[model samples]
Target: MTTKLPAAVRDRALQIAHHEMGHYVMARALGFVTGGVTLTVTMDLRHQGGACITLVRPISSIEAMKEHLEARMMVLLAGAMAQTFPSKPSAAKRVDKPKATAILKGEQGAEQDYAKIRELQHLLRNIAYPDTDPVSCERIAAQLKAMTDRVWDRTQKIVEDQAEAIAELAGALVDGMVIVEQWGRAADTYEVMYTGPMLERLRAVQAIPSLCVWTDSCGDAVQHWK
Candidate 1:
């Protein structure tokens, strides 16, 4: 299939291979398993969530919690970060676009997902999106940039200090990708297993249903079932 990437994305496949490798391995070193990096998808090939590393083991501890939250967010930002490469119009344009699957969906899907993204932006501004802070909008934007920056920094360390773990986790995630989406394991792969401490704090200490569990599509179809 044809794509709209710039002509200057030298070594297109190589950069994505390493970028994803960084995320996949970094998550494992932080204690969560993830899919191995892929070379098949590159600057030219990556679309929305094109270079995702299926997270494994989830975030369930303190250090692991911090690392996981920062790591995944960084991985989400990798697409934009990578665009800061051989060109400007491409880099600037790519950086401005949303870096998630919902962003790539059609107009209605983007609209549907806008609520969540707006909520994310709002919480990012307030830090209450996940109980981080209630900073002003400027501060929130700064914090988001800072957090993603940290993720990028730590991702480098993860690649350097934990290459083997990343390779292993990536392999495991890729092996399980079929079941990753099929067996109600999005949480296990993305949401559930990677729960941050704030989530745990809310659930265990605060005793709230902040993150409800909908085990099935059919359940979602019937509001009262869950």
Candidate 2:
């Protein structure tokens, strides 16, 4: 039997789903092979916020690796972005005004994501502009945000397109009724408890062609490999 989830738990799960799904969808759209996504609940205070995991393919070269790093950073940022601007009002409606204000005041994973982006900037600078001074870091930060902005629309569409799937998965996680079926080293399948029309809706969304398109800025920087 599936356990009933409290209002807070349900909301938290949906937040995690949107965040993680952002990574998963973008990674796939960028032609990076993904190992699937997983959502889990935790009692650990540090992780009580919830966990969403998306496994991606390994990078092959330094130049190619940099592109992958940038993509990953954007994916990471997508989670917090989704939280800040949820696709559906219901996802965050239950949050109290004060708590909602707090969420808006601070992003979900800003610190970690920013750190990763900074690290990626350092690596890219070393390769392309090693002689630059500290001020260059500021420029790199701007460039990173610009890159993220370029694809923001696509990310939003993914979140919106799969909103129901995310909610379903979130509900499953909250109920502690998720079933995992590993599929070799390629992908991992998650079976949620809920069924019926919602599943059909998710399949319909998945059937739609990808709306992701590379902006000129990112297109020039990250070569199309697939």
Candidate 3:
């Protein structure tokens, strides 16, 4: 059997969702509104790895710039922490050991049927090592705690109000679209289009995987190869 993930994972895409959502909500709580919650969307129904919510921090007055670089970095790394978080909300159960075993054993069961064949293109490939190991999830969470706590009520309210629309937007983005702010303060408003290189070589790795890599690697996987 391919790794089924937990059936519960289907409920929220993946465990890290709340973490990604936390950044989205907390950014607003911090009042950095260069643009209100910007990024593309996804609806593929796969776990989207962990970056389900793509939140761009607002750029305060450019003339007299004050940078929350640290804050934003913390926010950027928050979802991964959330995904690996051991809390009740994030970790539903222990690792799917049985499925993980099958995956390692070459079972290629139904659960992994789709992923196995798809990953064939990447056989023997090694993902880039994370620069920061021994990283603390709580440290990341601590940086975000203030914003999340500050805007907890408001953010959760926004989530509840727009849950359906958000889901649809994610689906639309997966189909082919970019979710940029129309102007400003247009909550969840997005314009779909096709632009950019549509295929740009990564600075890290010059090889670009066409449209397939475009979606899968967040356009960054090829950076090392470049």
Candidate 4:
């Protein structure tokens, strides 16, 4: 017998899928090795909020680490960014009063993402400018935001292109056929694993391309799709 999820449950599943897919797509674009992406839903009140986790390899060097953290921050922001900046709208359209207000208000999990971004920013600033004063942190934050904004358009394109893959992953989650016990957790929360050939299939079906082209400076200066 097929089971039907409640409307709320279904909506939440889609939300989690998009959020998780954002991380997965960005990580791959940045050439990070991902173990997989997992989406777990539980009935326990303590864990009522669903989670979408992307497993990635550890960074190897200080410079590489900074780039990795920045990439991760952008991926973290991508979920809430999608909620506020729909693909149909351009940056100009995003300036409308209602949309701008909604973006400012943010969406679920946005606080957690922002907190992570702030932590990464603090670390980056400390390493890059150890002698910087307190006010410089705010300045650094703005620069980080500006950099993130520069890539928002490309991020939206990736999200749009990978929509079918995301939905497929979400459907698999709802069907309960892809459960794996989460690592380091005593509780029996299950998550779907998308790794190796499975992940390649997802990317292939979507024909997703790199989100940016690196320049000689090693910065993502161009957004190219295949």
Best by lDDT: 4
Estimate the Cα RMSD of every predicted model relative to the unseen true structure. Answer: 16.5, 9.0, 19.0, 7.0
Per-residue lDDT over 167-201 for candidate 1, one digit per residue giving the tens place of the 0 to 100 score? 33323322222112335533212201222332223
Deviation (Å) of 208 in candidate 2? 6.8
Lowest lDDT block of 10, candidate 1: 205-214
lDDT of 3 by residue, 62-147 (tens): 31122233234333332222223233433232223344334334442223322442242122111111332336666544544543
How much does candidate 4 score in TM-score? 0.59
Sequence-dependent TM-score of model 1? 0.35
Better of 2 and 3 by TM-score: 2
Clash counts for all predictions: 10, 0, 15, 0
lDDT score for residue 80 of model 4: 52
> What are the per-residue Cα lDDT tens digits for candidate 4 across 1-226?
1245445544555556555665665566655555555565543311122233454647577766666665666566555543433322122212132442243245344466667766876676567666666777677777666655544554555655555544555455445523245678654443345554566665443454555422432545545432
10 residues in a row with least lDDT, candidate 2: 43-52
**Estimated TM-score per prediction?**
0.35, 0.54, 0.27, 0.59
lDDT of each candidate versus the true structure: 0.35, 0.47, 0.31, 0.51
The whole-model C-alpha lDDT of candidate 2 against the native structure comes to: 0.47
Residue 121, candidate 2: C-alpha displacement in angstroms = 2.9
lDDT, residue 8, candidate 2? 52
